[model samples]
Target: MAVSTASPTGSFGPPPPTTAGAIVVEGLRKRYGSDGPEAVKGIDFSVAQGEIFGLLGPNGAGKTTTIGVITTRVRPTGGRVLVDGLDVTQDQVAVKLRLAIVPQRPNLDRSLSALENLTFHAAYFGFSRKARRERALELLEQVGLAGREDDRVDQYSGGMAQRLIIARALIHRPQILILDEPTTGLDPQSRLFLWDTMRDLQSRGTTLILTTHDMAEADQLCDRIAIVDHGEVIALDTPRGLRKLLPSEQGVEVVVVAAGDAGTGTGDPLEAVRSTPGVERADVVAEAEGRTTVRAYGAVDAGDLVDRLKRAGLELVELRQLEGSLEDVFVHLTGRELR
Candidate 1:
């Protein structure tokens, strides 16, 4: 789906009584203190119902702050956010009732048993004694904790605790599930399990808003992505659409052993590769033991890159062709330097 990008100075009026999506963020802005830098600045986006929307960016790029506004944890300094057609600031309680958050860090009740944790949360939403009990048990079984429901959460592994947290979030049967770095510390197996769980929830018609730094995870799960940077939405598109923003769709990684004692070729390999036809961008990605890996993206020809590197006095050790990915789109938009 095509996504729109909002300008920094753009003006956005309040949403009507109802909106077309589950969430709407319009010209949102937030500043820490009177003189503090704006954590989020005039951002705009909307998440369709039942879509797995992603807020992707580097650390401190306002992804979390944007989520805070949507969840009503942080007050916006300017503009507005609407959750399920209800203004976040004006309808905080009603909005909260419709949203469930799985925070970046584990916020499970360690003192409570796994089952108690789920039931206790459900109780807040006014579930009756019998209903909460049955719901908790059902969720425990769904999250793979059926036999361990009586165990204290303190004894649970990181993965198990995460699962319990997910179950707890669902106790209220929220309309929108907000996952902030849901799989940060999980092992591959646990991450995959959570991905399956997310898909299951989506299948049941739950809208998901995800904040993540993991490019692969976003690429694999998000229906559409909003790339935020320095408190603004720089780009918004589907994964495939975002990939098209790059100059070329193919990439080549050429690993070369320096032919000289300087640990570099006699000539400038980077310049030579960049000057090669069909090569749009080139960067030295890695270097160790006299081998330097140059990753170039564009309509790159592996054979041409090898021959050019050879002419530059670099001996080819390995060469590999790669498909364009969200990571490349990120680097292209956010720059190659670590923030």
Candidate 2:
């Protein structure tokens, strides 16, 4: 379970002469202006056909700029990107035809009904009138907007508009779909619905490249993930593989209610756990509702840790063993929580 870390010179060299990947980026770099900062710096990764690849990073980590280059919206300051073997810079039109983008914000035609939106998008791809209508209806039904096809998109709820946007993106059936923070503003139920929709699209042979801050979403959907930070790829692996980057594969979450008295000798529960035997590392992951939740990693003896806390006058509210998580990996790599 060794996780691979990418270095600018070695691991991220040029891609192979020929690749079956749906999208390939090599030595990608971008800077805003003559004196401005570099946004993306020599990044490399590939997304296979029919694979759900995730790009994860905190804001300002250059993932957005990298995605901009991939979608052919931003001209790269260096390196090259290929979609289906066509250079994004040289084959803009051809590359665009094979890719569809679902932006984080809903950008459906506000003046048009949901059905008209889909039909118009398909028509732009040169579908026949009959084909446009049939395709629009099918997509509308598939996105659970069948009964609301005639309603103007501006009147739709956030989730509904998002669904319409997804339907519109699929109208032309592009070979690759780029979803930028697809479920960002969605409620839990709406988010789950979209997750299912994405899965369905994948089942139908669509390759998806997702950029999301939600570690759970990346863990659930991506076949592989590339974690970009400070304009470089820090780590790339499957969710499980990334978890292996932690000091230990096993961890324990302990929630303790602190005693109110000022004289309580528990200097810092987190530090205590760190000094405890068999514990490799410990972090205070959360503190709220008058409870402190500490996550300890390594060959931790949960019973021993709890007993030590009790000895120090800490009321143990909950204790649970945990599988190392993607969030842990992110923190381990960047030393910052994902925003």
Candidate 3:
């Protein structure tokens, strides 16, 4: 295990009364549409101290359902949610104050400028006008949105709008922050920028729980990740530990060099690669324009397989071994690509 790391723990605000272990959920369950169809069917997990917890899954995998229940946005069919040791259902008001959620969709007021968006959010949290302004400015600057503070949300780019949403979430300095698919559909640059912002927030002792289908995002940010698939957590561990479960597979992706729509190469490369040494499986295949490419699963050091292909004279023009990643484990467990 690569022993995950996160924000500082063990320091508190003055005595035995300060917050500890920001969020906790036990035997969480929720279902919709009746007895036959279940959204979340009895899952249990915990976020410790100041660590970043990742809730990962495909679309409609009970991630949003679990989050909604924990954040008090929706009532659960069963199971109790607690924040800072307070039952969410019983101490709804207190729990609400200590939590902040950045929704997957933008809810910013179009009429308000970026700064005004944040200010209005703080006002909803009941911050005084002056305090709201101070907090809004500080948060905007922290998220790299200070320069465009006066621009209306409609005028802002997708990245900019996302940044503003984060600032809005922080308006009250909540004990825990929840981000639901914070960077989906973002350009690469914007995605990286948001990741940096997430790191900054973690460094400042903000415990974060994020829901993302992006393996890279979960691997890079989560202290530990729980892989959700079809309404169940298929696996849970540190990113490295999760990959170790699949034994560090060397993924092979080939882009063929071809001249025409039809050509022959050993009948079928997919079948050939499946029989190669150290190969666990080979699933992805595409044939177009005299080219045949495949995505294969194999343990590290599959050079022998390459040598075998060379001996068989399979015109292998391109080959690169991708290092094992969380995506590999996800595929191994769920039998589907994360994307």
Best by lDDT: 1
Candidate 3, residue 296: lDDT:
73
Better of 1 and 2 by lDDT: 1
Clashing pairs for predicted structure model 3, backbone only: none
Better by lDDT, candidate 3 or 1 = 1
Question: Which stretches of candidate 2 lie above 4 Å from their native place?
Answer: 1-19, 248-322, 337-339
lDDT for each of the candidates?
0.84, 0.83, 0.74
- Give candidate 2's error at residue 219 in angstroms: 0.7
Between the candidate structures 2 and 3, which one is better when assessed by TM-score?
Answer: 2
- Give me the runs in candidate 3 sitting further than 4 Å from their true place: 1-19, 33-36, 247-323, 337-339
Q: Rank the candidates by lDDT, best first.
A: 1, 2, 3
lDDT of 1 by residue, 16-72 (tens): 224459998999999999999999989999998889999999899999999999999
For model 2, what is the alpha-carbon lDDT of residue 93? 85
Give TM per candidate: 0.75, 0.75, 0.72
TM-score of 3: 0.72
**Residues 1-339, candidate 2, lDDT per residue (tens digit)?**
111111223322123224478999999999999789999989999988889999999899998898899888999999999998999999898788778888978888899999999888877887778877877887788778888999988999998898788888877777788999999989898888878867877776678999998999999999999999999999999988888787665878999887666265674778767877988778999999878999888888888888788767677889987776798788778885545
Q: Supply the TM-score for candidate 1.
A: 0.75
